[model samples]
Target: MASLVKKTKKPALQPLSFHSHPTMPPPPQTTLSTVLHLVLFLLLSSTTTAISTSQDTSDLEQDCTNKWIHIRDLPPQFNLDLLKNCSEYPLFDNFCSYLSNHGLGQKTYNDSHSWYRTDPFMLELIFHRRMLEYPCLTSDPNLANAIYLPYYAGLDSLKYLFGPAVNSSFLHGLDLFHYLAHQDSESIWHKNFGHDHFLVMARPAWDFCQPLSNDPPIFGTSLLELPEFYNVTMLTFEARAFPWQEIAIPYPTSFHPSNLALFEAWINRLRRTRRSTLMLFAAGGGISANPNVRRSIRLECDNSTNVSLNGSITMKYAKLCEFVDCSNGICEHDPIRFMKPMLQASFCLQPPGDTPTRRSTFDGILAGCIPVFFEELSAKKQYKWHLPEEKYEEFSVFIPKEEVVFKGLKILDVLMSIPRAEVRRMREKVLEMIPRVMYRKHGSSLGLRSKKDAFDIAIDGTLQRIKSRLEDSA
Candidate 1:
């Protein structure tokens, strides 16, 4: 039993196997340096991966910043569904069918975007079609910088208000709400609450904001007020203040030239012509909420009637809606005569309609006539996105609405006081501005193929705004 075994010497430390127990202890001191080296190697790899990821994200953002817009491929039903009943409204009944001709109605072959007045409701169609024809549109979401939501929210709501449905605004609104809410979980709008998304409409913002019980039934819904729409930007015909979510866009007009050459030719012809009238007031200021403002305008115009200013610009007046037949939601006057007043007048009166904005302002601009605004709300703050940032006095005349109303200030005198040379300069400015305000019959109206026109400017301006907002958030 005492014949026993021999003992061998053992080292104090040894390399540890990674395949040790779950709560493995530290490696032996002899292997500690190796463990530290391994840790450093892994850390470098992770850091490299992270830097690469950051670079990729930055590249994507920069690319988007340069004019990449992703259009949501919405279900066809969303666009075409309401279009079935589109013509139910009197003003826009023919517009839905005229999309093929660029909303030119039956006058598509008129060799120019003239003759027939373009219905204002053509906006929803125009903006949607513009995106389809734009250079910045991207089908791939990953490559997109901003998202476009082509909901036709204006036309969709207006049909109910102006159609036989009567107060059925909620019908389409509820449907739209559910449609947005039930989108695929991966939808960008679903997660971001549509912050990067935008929709353009021809209607005012008031139509989308739901009214109170005592509020006038404008046939609207709570779509804009809903929590889902808080982050989305709105391009509207007339954007009111307070929420500051909406921006004003110009109303649709009849002069949608196919090419810049043609547009320039038309403008040059107008510039060459002489304006015989100092100011022309075609609309009646007969009766409104504030009757005095309009009545005074009527009285001033009447007093100045048939009187030539400085023996060059005569003052003329007419009541458009009453004398002109606009029964079909468009005036049926001879195209030549209709535009004559605007074209002959050096400055055309642009008073407020139901809203602060008026299509007449744009009409006068297209006619190569400077706009004369009585209400600041009419054009001053309404078109900040589209107009030049120049002072109002440069392109328009602002005879204080109250001054003209109560004090009986002479509009003719105020206009005559400005030098005739200055008036010529103002007219030239309006001629240059024609392209910016007009929606072309074709996207390539200017010299460049697919040159940006009104539609392009509006969309691009909105995208720039969206980028700024995102940066602020970050």
Candidate 2:
């Protein structure tokens, strides 16, 4: 009976409700608890969604841009106050003005009657000499100091008080003109003998025999002997002559088979001794024209000194891409590749090799790279003649050779901390200056054409120095 009854156990009695029993009013709610749970769930879900959205946006933005694009968008930092807006300076205008003003520029070549009358090259020498004397003309104090004191007063006097002395010194110091004459031995010997006989005869007696022990010859035999005699005589005397002066004027005494090497050695010595000066050696054809020069520059930059040599002043050479080669005819290599990286980098090392002024600095500026300069060695000094100490505060970073290693390390650290976007903007600013700052002597003439010359822009900061110096002296 028990087994038969257990097989049919009644299902648990369904709760009898008259109208679904009011659906068992959900378990009595704790208002606070319920509200808290709902809020927590919502916050968790929202946070997850927000994180996903942020990450997606970041990825998208990153995917759309690169370092170059950002750099290209930045603004330029060079001071343009001095430059005439990408146009060449009016040499003719300056010359005309000088002529009208009865300045040294008015002097004509070889009047034959006037003592001041001389070769055309002498005029250029005089002009350069005069330019170096006036503090106003020379933007930097160092350059002014480099000008010989005697040359300074003579050239700056407006009357060219030392023109005769300059001409005489040039004639005697440089030998190429006489060598080029190729006169008959009689004429050559007689002419030269008459003019230089005192020097020639005095040299052997003074140097070799030491005839006058009290006031021995001030210079060596090499200084007194003619070029033809240099090979013939064994006097072995070192000439104490300004290499540049000799090259500029040309004379028998100045002619040396090793003149080129001597000039290079002199330049090297100047660069080495004057650590404050930034040297720029520019050459065409990607520095292949003179690898030795390039090597020398590299040695100077990398090993000799750590002073703030402009990146453009380095002996290190980089082949620029074709796109940035403004010198369409002169620059044969592709400029874009070189420029692209330079624009990206903070410094563009430019060491001139063969060209008058290192073109690399302009390339660096075009690429938006700040030039690291050795002020004195760069031929650009012949034009701008001063370091833009203030204006360059924003765009360029200068370092003396002694501080290069330390300063370079510091700069790297600073650069790393800067945001990528900001760095790009800075570079872009530099690149933007190409049209305004760079000048192609042949393409756009010389100097700047628009408002001011590149020299003005470059020396804007130095102008402040002039003002300050003037004020201080006042």
Candidate 3:
């Protein structure tokens, strides 16, 4: 018992206080929760940046792959949504519906109010009337006239066929008004009438302020008192004196060299004026020995103060087909010689002769070249496949006067400045439009598709402009 008590007493004083230790250091202020939060934040930021980079790469690749994005490629639902933004016009809806229902071959009747009517003469008359009273008739009278004559004649025929009792006076009145409205102040009708009355009479069918009146009014005071007439007017470009002063007259008899002269003059002019960037002309025969006009053209070009002609000149006019010389239409059928050169050119200058609208320009457009146009001798005739002004702005070019001196900019230089790839794309777009802008007379598929025509392109452009103008006005 004594030994056990002594062992317990010795254990109490065994450990002494040890304050300063060399082996251990102090702990840091950072907690485990704070360290975990910083790591998670860095991981989320990195993941988000990687995802954004991957999306950007994907978008860039898609844009590079799809070159020609057509309007049709848009989703049907998206297209419908866009239509909702359009004006609610019953005329447009009905027109689109008619187009959809007719498909292209639908029989066009004289009685049909629709644009697809086969009897274009009466429609031509209506168009001419509209032109007289509007600003739309300034540029191409042949086109205006061509559209109206056939349509009006058909309308007159339809009236006679439907009702024998219908008086010819109605037609006479319509015709007379059109003639008087277009007449000059020196003409018989304008000379006798007072100005105010004449204007009033003309007001029903023609634009008052239009500057193109061939004849100015002799009397202004008494013309405004006339009663309004309800007669339906005809649309047609009237035959008249040539508008532009004669710059140069090619030897009309010599087809080849004279044609070449015209082509060279146009090219030189376009070169002088940078407005027109590209030009092409193809003839059906070799250059004539009698290069009278050609010599003149060369002299003018050499003396040209504005443009210094530096580009290489290649004469492709000799390579075209001479269907005009062929008696049996055999040369016309030879597609290889006739169409190939035109296909190569950027524009085909069309001059009127054989068929009304079948100029070299027609052949060129058929071969995928844009038609550079001048008003024809037959002012009122319309080319069935003529591209409108706006479309022509994108696809074609026009020279108004005969003298190339007015145009002093270099078209070739401007075109050359454009990237080759862009020019190639524009050429392709023109080629694609050919089928829709050309017509084939042979019933054979030698040219563009028969269903499509030049007027279609023009009308489509006109309607679009009208709609746009209306929207802008609104």
Candidate 4:
């Protein structure tokens, strides 16, 4: 056995075989150089891929930036003149004051409040101002992908809407149509019969759609009824259900943040707010034609004049409800008086006002209060461009007006039945939607290119829609 044994000398270093060994010692210099080269190759490849990915992202952002739009230099009567002589409107006592602060109305909140007496119908002025400052605006129409008509159609309709010359409601709209007809044949108007063009309406679609049966002309015009306007896309506060060129936009709220920091601060304040009341109803009882709806809601919240003001709880299950009784219609434009109750309540009542749509729907969102809508058209059917249609329950509750008015189902009982954890989640969702519905102050030098507010969303959607149509036609 001793004679058969053979011994070999151990080398200074053993050769590393990556293929053979699960674990191997460090390689020699030559092999180490190869390994380094492999690593360097991988790193370079990875860097190339990274650069490519960055370039892709940058290209996407550039594409968005390149989605240029042109604003038709409309006559002053269309926009500027309307604002200059806003005094003539006489819709409000100080109608001209609403034109100040970029059409946000006089500052009701001087410093920290950031609120104004914004008229619900003042969106035309607000939108025009925002479009003027749009970053991608091109003066050359040939280079434009979409055209904006800054016509004060809403303001223009006011004179004819409520006036005696109801038959002449289509005068200004016809003037606009004639103005477009006179444009060069090669112009954008003729390119797609104004299909690539869009305008923002400060009123509901019904106000512009005057039917032949509309006797006494109860505040409506034939503007939308114009055949020439069929192709033009309209961004309205309240759009018709279907087959109309109207798209519903968020109603202008009193809280318009000047900058992103201010916006974030407001959001944080809402998140940290201590809600003391179970629910809030801050509108005028006189606003709704169906008196029973408001009466039922008021009675359920123990806010009816007899029960709330007299300090008598007639109901067995009366809850601490906040009411901003704008019985005289004073709180309609004043946000400071109305939003406080919303901030202190878990839910804000958004029953149908003069129309099914109310400015309070968006205001409740701004205050981070979950909205309690009584009508489908109130919030769910509208705001498809801004609100999550599928996730309505995430941020809102729907109680049919028929149930409350006829069946006598209690709103407080329904809202109180939801677990507190669910309420917190809903509130968070509501807070998350504040920015989308809010029309933040435009032309801020604060580099808010990334933060798309209501204006941004509407414009982007409009441009995209036009682009898709143009592409399909091409």
CA lDDT, candidate 1, residue 100: 35
lDDT tens digits by residue: candidate 4, 1-474: 000001123111221011122143321112333334433443353334324433335545586464777777666566655554454445533356466555776655333334566787788878876765565665567767888888888877767854445467756488788777785555568878887899988989988888645556556887887888887889998987774688888998877666555566567667777787778888877334554788887676664323332222223224456777877766665555666667778888989867899888888888888999998898788888799699898899999999999998878768767777999999999988887898877555464456778998998788887887777767
Query: Model 1 clash pairs?
Result: 260-445
Candidate 2 local distance difference test against the native: 0.28
Better of 3 and 4 by TM-score: 4
For model 4, how big is the CA root-mean-square deviation? 21.8
- Residue-pair clashes per prediction, in order, are 1, 63, 52, 0
How well is each residue in 379-463 modelled by candidate 2, as lDDT tens digits? 2233222223244545554443324333333322232344445544655555444433432111122222332323234233233
Better candidate by TM-score, 2 or 3: 3
User: Given candidate 2, what's the lDDT at residue 417?
Assistant: 49
Question: Candidates' lDDT values, in order?
Answer: 0.61, 0.28, 0.29, 0.70
Q: Pick the candidate with the highest lDDT.
A: 4
Superpose all Cα atoms of candidate 2 onto the true structure and report the RMSD in Å to 1 decimal.
Answer: 36.0
User: For model 2, what is the error of residue 219's alpha carbon versus the real structure, in angstroms, after optimal superposition?
Assistant: 16
Can you rank all candidates by TM-score, best first?
Answer: 4, 1, 3, 2
Q: What does candidate 2 score on TM?
A: 0.26
Q: Which ranges of candidate 3 are over 4 A from the true structure?
A: 1-338, 350-358, 373-388, 398-403, 406-419, 440-474
lDDT, candidate 4, residue 392? 95
As for lDDT, the candidate ahead, 1 or 2, is 1
Q: Which tens-of-lDDT digit does each residue in 1-474 have in candidate 1?
A: 010011113111211011112243321221334333433443353334324433345555564455777666566455544455544567534344343343443341222233333567657766765566555555555556688876777766765666664555545456655666686556676655666778876688777776434244565665666666677888888887665578888987766656555555566668676676667765544444565555665666666645543333332223211122223333421233335567767877776655778777887788888888887778788788678556567788887777877776877778778777898888888877777787876445337345556787887788788888778766
* lDDT pick, better of 2 and 3: 3
**RMSD (Å) per prediction:** 26.5, 36.0, 33.8, 21.8
